[model samples]
Target: MNARIEADAAFTDWMQHVQAGMEGTLDAYLPAVTEIPARLHQAMRYTALDGGKRVRPLLVYAAGELFEAPEELLGRAAAAVEMIHVYSLVHDDMPCMDDDALRRGKPTVHVRYDEPTALLVGDALQAQAFAVLSGNVEEQYAARQLKMLHLLAQAAGSTGMCGGQAIDLASVGMTLSLAELEQMHRLKTGALLRAAILLGACSGKHLTVVEQAALEAYSCPISLAFQVVDDILDATADSATLGKTAGKDAADNKPTYVSILGLSESQALAEKLRNDAHKALEQFGNKARRLHELADLIVQRKA
Candidate 1:
């Protein structure tokens, strides 16, 4: 029990360190508030810095460390992935989409700024993400970084996150099958997540076909597990706890794991996916400890 407690403490310490470091990394990459587009840059900084669980960035760090990627490379990759994620959130909370007022325990970008400003924030952030991913890297890493940029684009493009959002908008008030629901989330939520893991691993060195396959298998389940836990929390937790509106799925009459499978079943599926995620990492042994810990964190997070 003491050993388990100590392990938990260590993971907590590591998580906090990465989360804090990301603030500086993201801040450095973002345009200064005094830039020519002062308001836009300010809103960009406001939305990107000092908020949320940075799970995608943590995933990038954890996966990159597996292949012994350089810290500089990992930082750029993590920041790029997070920029795409934050931009999505900004657009998602607009009146045309989820239309929520709160995010990361504060007013969302659309609520804090006008809709037009929010629109530009998302667009500018999306452009900046690619620029950061592709810039300031050594000549040796240029080739790999270009491919990483392409991967990030696909994940954020019409066939990835945007595609998923489209499905979600269309899925509202409709009864979707279990398979259908999973497919939607795989693109919507999972694509970027998969990108984070792959980007991290690729940042270090060239991967063998087997290495790539193993990482793919590992990402598949955790991606779904992330969304399952999210649905569970949205159904059971409160607005204050979630830092956003709770029960929004039901309120919007959207399909979710909880709504389709019931609360208990959704919880069970999350656990099963957690197990699958752990199993997929067996080939990496202790090298994958951080990834394993992250799987648990994603499934067990309260908010």
Candidate 2:
């Protein structure tokens, strides 16, 4: 197969594996939480199972595969990453935040259930992510697992996603510098992406300090590229194709790359970032092909 086709196939297989792993986690864990009300459970399951691109999970598996990590172990890590992502989305769509009524081509948790239930579901998903990590049977390295948990907590907590969200809310309708926009996205999206690759590498115990550094460098550009593409799609794509409301950022008066840099310049920036991301993986030879392709796919994706 051609490199791009092979990469797409690998990504498809990984997505199926991730979806199965996530369903398994829900089956195993949801029943154990007997105290959870049925409504809350429904809300949680509704949003959690809602279809997404599952990019973060794919990154986890790809990073692990690059290092020859075991499938079972990588699946566990992928599940954990996805749990965190779903939790963030549920909370982000609440009325107090983005107030989004739709996600993944369906009503958001708040729209389906209520704000309170949505909040609770988000909380439960976040807690369940740590629980899943703790329950990983294939984790032979205690120190590595602990490190992975720590990385996730930091990324999902005040220093990362939460912080970015706070800044984003504060910046509504206000013009921000390119530096400010980059700062916002680095914490909002980059931290988890960086952690996804790092945790996968850590799981395999195959990452040299230099390799870690290279991946970190690669993540920065790709993360920004991801956000830029999102901005572009928000302006151009509809909710049905995007799986979320289109033109929302502009409607909400949020500052975006498109607003700051213009559409053409934002696209050029994404291309430059994609090139830089590919260059960061050059040292790894063919083993890094998927990673490079992933960068291209992120910028080129319609949604």
Best by TM-score: 1
**How well does model 1 score by local distance difference test?**
0.95
Which runs in model 1 stand beyond 4 Å of their true positions? Answer: none
TM-score of each: 0.99, 0.92
Q: Report the C-alpha displacement of residue 110, candidate 2, in angstroms.
A: 1.2
| Colliding pairs, model 2 | none
TM-score of 1: 0.99
Q: List the residue pairs that clash in candidate 1.
A: none
Writing each residue's lDDT as its tens digit, candidate 1 over 209-231 gives 98899999999999999999999
